[model samples]
Target: MACRRLGGVPWLFLILAWLPALCAAQTRAPYIPASPDVVLQQVPPTTDPRVRRFEQLRLDLQRHPHDAKRAVTLAQAYVDYARSTGDARFLGRAMAVIDPWMRRPLPPIPVALVHATVQQSRHFFKASRQELTTILAREPNNAQAWLTLATVAMVQGDMDEANRACVKLANTGGDFMGMICTASLRMLTGRAPQAYALLGLVEDPGPKAPPEIRAWIEGLMADTAMRLDRAALAEQHFKQALQWTPGDNFLLADYADFLLDEQRPRDVLALLQGDSASDTSFLRQVYAETALGLPQAKADAAAMAARFAAMDARGSHVFQREQAGFALHVQHDAPRALALAQQNWTVQRAPQDVRIYLEAALAADQPAAAQPALDFVQRTHLSDPSIDRLVARLRSDAMAQAAPRAKP
Candidate 1:
């Protein structure tokens, strides 16, 4: 029995592609392949049947570069591949496949949609929204466009816009997809307990359901559980999701975060040690390594610095959140971290973004700087123990700073 959470539209392909872009340089040493089938790169080896099919698609597209249908198909495959493995590098491949269409003033609906998906994957929210808007203006009933638009809005902290898009999605797609979409927004807006109950009643999708969709539902449940402070339940949900798609980068990073929060740094290391190609996983490994006082943390931090430098050269601001964390924890630069966090807040207002902003403000002794985040918390009624504790600390610090000091 398929659970009526988010029906149809094959959202599995687009969901994780919405994760923050965190590609990093590969640091593994080069090795010669001893066997013809040996794979030197990629999360799953090319020997996997799926990868073989993808390669064949790529070859076909290469032979017919001007084939719009073939280009869209392959680009969609690349997006799915990136979501499955948490590898943003595949996004570039997707872009290359769609580049021919994008150069034109107005590409076809399918090309524009895929292009917008890739843009979102790279954190180009404004560009993505513009593309989605163009598509919707032409075809208002485009369920995928509405869903993608809603996501871009949510990421940017525009709850009103997101809700509007969700309503449209429900009307166009189905109640289930709308419910799942709205439930996610509610999870972030202080109604997590309710969202958890609503989703729990949803029966798991049957064997016919796509694995990515199964993973997405389980991951959403896990995240909602975490917001409600149900750590044990959250862990179970995370594990279940991983069973469906173990190599999902966003899932691994999120689980690593849970482990870190529980003070199980060793477990985080065990989970993310071999996944440094993704900056998200790489940063988590640094956090775990630092917690355990491992010698390798220093070298990893240096590598992260180099990666950030490269990102800066490219003028990319997508990883500002991760960069802020590294600056604070790994580089021990509180002021720099605070600046990055503040700048990042201007782009993303997710709970994690707000928490980092609060943390950076506190570390920099700039309680005044945290007012925006504090206001956001109060306004949204966001539920998270960690965020609440940070709020309390900031309030306490502000009071201490304001109290009259006795004359010495």
Candidate 2:
């Protein structure tokens, strides 16, 4: 589920490392523990054991704030929660938990990993890469460090570095993780068919693999299929992923985009209903509402505007792509959307990024401004039906504009 807009790899292995025992234990009725306000989603005591463990960990860390080991453990748990919930605030909480070791010349491996995770979540790729490099220099056989480095490199569009890190992972880590790492990069680099076929070779680990990992692989397959114009296969893979990890924000957002592209706004609404806690989900809901011309669209657009304004006021520019889409589709400000999309392109060149840039450029009647996107398509040899249609339309419009006026 590590789509371009979502940022970074899925980090399923990190979550797998901390999964609690699944056995049902005999105990009294569950009660809420007095924990910090950092918990974003409230899990009733009687339900998910993961939530119970998270609550206990929070309370334990609060009691022994000076204990480095407990702090690292809690921070790691918070990072896992952030990944599962898509709540960026949990990343901030993870940073707070590890604040004590932030300035150390060489923090513990656990703390360093948490720090890098938080940095990457916040879009600080360079900082995260630096930390991971330092960790790997010290522990050359660190599988997690290699995987993280590959993820950071992929996000930054440095495929060469990502390939190198994947090779390192394959040498140190098992083939399963390494294959996933390499296949994801291949999918982005115009080898969708090969990536999909290679990924199909991954043997099902059954209980050995976490559900999240399986869901992530299925999601990637769905994306590859979509790029290949295999709509039926893509939808099937998406369905399989949702079955594995129901209500995952990343999966929900990605499927909503697919529905939007298919002109199924109602399905998008149904999928994202009552799921607006994360910014990604909220953006998708806004898009769906706008497409349906729902009464809530106005309010949702205004709310998103205000949220972006607040982020701008705080000097946070990590959401330029989402903001640009809102501007183009919701606010109807083509120029502003083009500007934001251009700014976003300078940071990430994923296919979605190119699409938005092309969209804004076309909407604003600035075909020349879309050269970067067209160049990207040519350079990467990316093939997507939607992008192909857009390119054709852009050419048609340019020709229509350039036609001579014979009779004045």
Candidate 3:
């Protein structure tokens, strides 16, 4: 999930899979630069209140560059903007805004939170968790700290720690956050139906809930419903989420994926029109074009490849999952896809991650290579019809290969 800025305050919600870790220890490395030449779409001047407020904050930060409070505020706003727009440049911009305190051993809590948010965005999971831990040790009742810790733990597949952090968050009057956090973990642990119902309880079609929170909950419900193979329910939740927060890149990408899976490539094309700034969105467009055998598929594929190459040149492997999927499905490089998927599995074990690993392994004709994902599925009790079918096919293929050739 992406962070959101509301009423000049920034709040984070664990939306989807976990972020990656740049390293176990923090370093003052140069920021990974995104491609400057890639232009997705141009936006005209906006009169939106939120945009106006963010601009004011930017002006304030620019005027008071040395002011820690202003810097953190602007950085948080940037982080929120990055989450909303799926623009990598915003994340780098956030890091730049907080560079003054990057190496500080004891920055203020707000500054530290901003630093951790930047690190988390860059996939430095261990460093982000450490920053959260340090903050919690000093201010034990910090709701944001607890929420961030829970998010980091969930991403790392440390459910026990995540659940404990959720408990702490709930104790700090974050009942709604706690419910969503724990429910998300439950869904991953094969309690999809229960998770869906629990989220419904939190979002009972009431006007009392914040639109942002409702949108996030509906998105999660949509995901869980999809896992349960309730296509209609999933579509309903997806549409409802969009109604609440229109033009959300994450929602659009998720819906595009659902459309792609349903073989409605044209629907995906229409859904993601003019939304290519984000790597994920562009990747989905590539998938749709490839599926429909459109000429633009080649150009889109080349553009994505160049983007990934830029990430590589900067030594940023934070997008292993997306890269692996691209390699496997579009590039048709099964071995490379398997390698990337394996690397990705070490960081996140979400169902999407597992599916990629399994798909890559199968395509590579390396059933043994898929054991880790299969084991994860068994251990977590994760159930997806597509994943199960793939597992069964792999098993049957293995059996056939091992069977004796009597008439040879």
Instruction: Estimate candidate 2's alpha-carbon lDDT, on a 0 to 1 scale.
Output: 0.79
Structural similarity to truth (TM-score) of each candidate: 0.87, 0.83, 0.85
The better candidate by TM-score, 1 or 3, is: 1
Every candidate's lDDT: 0.82, 0.79, 0.79
**How would the candidate models be sorted by TM-score, starting from the highest?**
1, 3, 2
TM-score of 1: 0.87
Evaluation by TM-score, superior candidate among 2 and 3: 3
The candidate that achieves the highest lDDT relative to the unseen native structure:
1
Positional deviation of residue 290's Cα in model 3 after best superposition, in angstroms:
1.0
Which of the numbered candidates is closest to the native, going by highest TM-score?
1
The residue pairs found clashing in candidate 2 are: none
Please give, for residues 1-408, the per-residue lDDT of candidate 1 as tens digits: 000001122233234333333232244445568898985675657787767878899899889978999988988988887876667667767877777676677788998898888778777788788879999999999999999999888888888899999999999998777887888889888899878876765537667888888888898899899888899999999999999988788889889989999999999988876677887888889889888999998898788899888777656677898889889988889999999999988878888898889989999999988999998889877778899899999999999999999899
Which structure is stronger by lDDT: 1 or 2?
1
Candidate 3: the clashing residue pairs are: 1-15, 1-16
Candidate 3 per-residue lDDT over residues 1-408, each given as its tens digit? 221111111212211111233441254565555887775556523776666777898898878877888888878877776776777566656766776665466677887887677667767787688878988898999888888888778777777888899899989846777788778888888888888877877876467777777888899999899889988889999999989988777788888888888899998888888466778889999999999999889998999999999777656677888899999999999999999999988877767888899999899998888888888788778877788888897788777778999895
* lDDT over C-alpha atoms for residue 173 of model 2: 97
List where candidate 1 sits over 4 angstroms from the true fold: 1-44, 62-65, 404-408
